[model samples]
Target: MKRTTVIGFLGSTLDASKQDAARWNKWRPTVGLCMQPDLRVDRLVLLHGRQHEGLAKFVTQDIASVSPETAVEPHTINFDDAWDFEEVYTELLDFAERFEFEPETEDYLVHITTGTHVAQICLFLLTEARFIPGKLLQTQPKRGKPDAGGVWTVIDLDLSRYDSIAKRFAEGSRTSTSFLKGGIETRNAAFNAMIDEIEQVATRSSAPLLLMGPTGAGKSLLARRIYELKAEQHRLSGAFVEVNCATLKGDNAMSALFGHRKGAFTGAVAERAGLLRSADKGMLFLDEIGELGLDEQAMILRAVEDKRFLPVGSDKEVESDFQLIAGTNRDLVRAVAGGSFREDLFARLNLWTFNLPGLAERREDIEPNLDFELKRFAAAEDTRVTFNKEARARYLSFATSAEARWDGNFRDLSASITRMATLSPDGRIDRPAVEAEIVRLGNLWAVEPEQGTDALAEVLNADAIARIDPFDRKQLSEVIVACRRNPSLSATGRELFSVSRQQRTSTNDADRLRKYLARFDLTWSDVS
Candidate 1:
């Protein structure tokens, strides 16, 4: 049984990609996001909304162009209707139960989604693993079919808006293809850092840098950004070698990083040049570097340090003079102390490390992020959309006030915005529509956020940390309900934040979550 990937492209977003923007095809974005080429891809699943039968067929036709035999599995939910997490999850699980996973399947399990809420959640719930560990993609659907072809108009989400918050989704957590929207100072600090690092690296050896951050942060995108920001003289011939550490942890890890000699292991009947060697004279990014086992880490250290790693079963060391930039959310410091991570190796790699911040920290940055999200989501929804000031204020108020924890960081925010924009009533995202989104976001963190409480007080009590982890999505949902019930000062951040005694009524659930993800090793994708 060949393992096949399930690429999910939901509703209007997919339709627009086909009829308008190339991303509407979904296949390109789905397949494109996957940095791995050896991974076998079997099915391209299209989860179309129920109302957009025309759009569903439209996607099906385009997918036929990509994969002729693949069928379009279209399902729908009223985007305009207010729905809870369970409602969506249950439907998704029940709906996907019919699709059985074959044992012999290999290569891919890509779930590129847009409209089918049920299918996307179903895939998340029913996947063999607790959480499907792979790249999550969102393509900006074209707003409309351009009168002329090849216009290639694409909108980007500016993630820098959040104060100190953009860091959480950077590097290791690089998932989305955009930046946060926010204040210029903090975002400028980040750009300065990138420029500084690039200058320093180019000056010396121009070795590849390893980025480390949690899941859903924009690691890959950052790598691309680094490439973009690099001086053309330095960037030329210095390609970016991006590889997910999770996917390459085991046998694949060895073969992928180091070229293997023929009969290297049971599966390797033939010789193959691994990614590390192929990446020579260029950059090699070991994404999710924390996921690598001690032995694997040692092998990576050798490759990065000495630029010589042994091919399995061959005493001869293969030379790979590429600079290494590894990213991971796991606490390598802990791994080193536990004897799982080599202290020497960790020190060698820790020459420069940057930690990213989650969205809530810079609640003030939400508006820009919201604006950026709207453009991106609208294009993906194939419907132009905007948020009324009242709607924007209502959304920001609740969102900043809530105890919502987005475990997936910016990725979660991107997904939420995309879903809401596609479903906004009358294609206008007013305060109510945005509030509906906040509710949907609240569903992710089960804690009820007490309104009108001190925001600083809430952080002091660590309410935000309690919002996401250890609690299942359902539990977080329940917690949100609880906060809603209490709506007290403790429910909000207290004076812990500032010495100024006078306080403001704090927001709820979402803020708490943003705090938690930023703390500890929450930035790691696989870190629980």
Candidate 2:
């Protein structure tokens, strides 16, 4: 059985009775605590000043007579005054530090009933802060019945069990979620729950967190909010550094992420402190992480594991202890299968992966977000703007309807609101403005075949673009565009070869599209 050890102050003032029998039998808290039937106090460390030596001895004798099993040890501690908060606290804290503890084989309790208010507070602080590995035990004497005895209770200082404390934590999480959503009162329970979890992780952990979602799903926004929250709480001291991996390319990517010495590369005129170093003791938000090359991924893995990495052209390794938050729209598991992303790196970051819902998945949030966007616009432009009753209802109706596909998610909504607010006469958005904005959004969302060709060409390498004949380029562009708009290969292929497929006896549209994509080693993951 584990031994119960009690550490407390000498009750010199409380147990100052002149009569021997009265001193022993009186309702002294420390002695009364030992009198409890169920509690077996194996040892007691009574702290006292030199003047209280006699008192300590008397108390020890009293305890020994009642409970002989308890080994009472009186410890001499110097103190000018028990009421001096700092002096008492420092001495007690030092005593706690120097005292040998066998926590694995013994349970410890700090008796708060015998000490002064200051001494009791200090003991409680020490225990609560984990400076002293023990729970608090308070003994209450029976009122008007000295012989009737008192009650003793053990207090575990875990704030999570308390309803008010838990509610406060929940409120903080809601505030953080609001910060991420640009002050929007988000009504979607699923999205709110996800944000709550993210806030918890952000507050408690420094682990690499992976945010997986569709484009414009608030990953970057949430990551920034997490950094801001940490900074606000003084948990982080360094600047928030962010980089979109999709925009990174070749030597520039390396030089940009890991610092480069002077003359590291052709145009390297001066030494540069990269994004990693800039984010030391802070946060690093890597957006569109799927776009990072395998070599960069390997370097990042090493950096994440051990806060050290070699610069672009330097042999010496630099250190950057940073918390990582990575965002990606790609299905990384599929990317791992396609041999594009590193499996080990994915495994490391996947530990804290959170999938954020796209706007279409949480359409209920659109109405509130609409108001949020207008407010944001008003703040930015220094002009108040509100939609008229009819106009507001109409916009919300269209936005929440099945026809309104929020392809760009919150980004599209913000832009739509900004345009309307800018064009609105005075501070009010009329019906005409709302109608025009809806048409504008509809036209923008409509995927034109020619526009898809432009987008595909933009992503393609110069060499790959040059290799394809003009005729094949036109066909490939249209096909790629179709693939992007449609979720499945069958849908895209049928649309692409509608005329040609009909001419054939039987059409294997998906197979045909797959073969065409194979010419460029492009898979569904690469296109969509």
Candidate 3:
């Protein structure tokens, strides 16, 4: 029975704009259908609060309306309707402790949402409970209009992979209260050492921080986390402004960051404050700072370095006092070398720098992240959860194992976690789920959209190997997938390698091709 795959549906009492309701609607049936071989025995249970009995019935009936055999039965736990946050949490914890005790095989898949206070309590406690591992899914409810679509965040639970990020976050949980608020799990020694520097900058009287890391390495989150911690100290309630330079391309972009004077331009019918003004004495997070044009960078550099800015069509420099935090995925040093970025601007912004570690580098944070994820999943389901020891060990073993290079960092960790959590049965994760995820990951890396192997082609076209940055297991798998998709050498070269735009420019293409192929130590025949 411990080996059977089981899928469980969990939802909260608070249904926001019914978007959470709709997400769970899509999640359950899709998982059930995706859970190949239904005859394996255990029943699929959809857990919801007694208050949401009607909503629960609706979700299941809706799923059944489309697929009758996969209808999820509503499982209501014992809890009082009128309970305080603590009481609700305690009750949910009690339920979560007994989650895996159901008389069925240990494998389990649990789906949920971030709502009820009880949900937060129960699932937060699930991390401490070592039961069988399973899939953990969470949906954040959005409010406003009913018909508009809401956002959902999903992660498969594999604690072993995220050990580095999880451990740091856990350590941070003692001092910072927003543990539940999303963060990059950068506990790797590289980031552990770097975070201390970042913290110092946050505490410094006027030290500006420039966050340098790969794309989606939680730079923005870390910046916001620093602001949240410091804002409370000053007793100043200011807003946090996030500016993605890569996204800013035109006049609308100009006005969006720096304010425009009234009748400043054709569209300037009225005076409007930009994100900088809105941030006032708050924190301004500039993401992808390297992507900014020299002109925009010059504008921001003046404002941040000197605390003054000139509005559009106006010569008067506005005095703006705000904490400036910058994040970039591009290499600023290289940008400086290429003359794409200003050395003076880089020097000014280099008051404080924090380099965040990618997910693969930090093996320690994975388990804690896994536990945190489970707690999240449990809370969303309004159910308490636990990870079986065997599944937990298997999940963690991958961390210290030889084959892993987490190129995407925390982003990849979240993806792997979501896959593992949703595939577990009876709330207990099994080995099969882990293996299945590896295969899925392998397939993901095997190919690009219209090319064969980026790595393999890079190798054959170029003389040197192109080592993948933030190397880890997941991305390596994807490289393999790319190789599988494109089998021929000429295709690898002409299609993947020959990307240069110059006369007989196979030199550039061949260089890229060689670097990619060298990562896997393969030649043209490897794909063939």
Query: lDDT of each prediction vs. the true structure?
Result: 0.55, 0.85, 0.60
TM-score each candidate: 0.48, 0.69, 0.51
lDDT per residue (tens digit) for residues 404-460 in model 2 = 777787898888889998898689998889899989988987755246565465446
User: Candidate 3's residue-wise lDDT over 240-341, tens digit each?
Assistant: 889888888878777878889899999899887888888888888999988787888788888887788888877777777888889997657757876889
TM-score of model 3 (CA atoms): 0.51
Distance (Å) between predicted and true CA of 173, model 1? 24
Where model 3 places Cα greater than 4 Å from the true spot, the runs are 1-187, 379-385, 399-402, 423-425, 448-528
Off by over 4 Å in 2: 1-66, 71-134, 138-154, 160-163, 448-528
Q: TM-score winner among the candidates?
A: 2
Which of 2 and 3 is the better model by TM-score? Answer: 2
Question: Per-residue lDDT tens digits of candidate 1, residues 1-528?
Answer: 654555465445423553556453343343232222343345556554567677667656665664554544554544343246666666555545555544444433445344456445555555534244333334433346532111111111234666456877565233221222121223334544554554455435555465665566556656655554442446546566678777865677777777788887887888888888877777777777777777887887777768888987687887877766677766677666656578877888887675544454444545566677777766666778777778766766675664555556667777877776777757777666676787777676654333223322222235554553553434433333333223243432232233332444654434554364355333212221
TM-score, candidate number 1: 0.48
Error of 2 at 464 (Å): 18
Clashes of each: 83, 0, 75
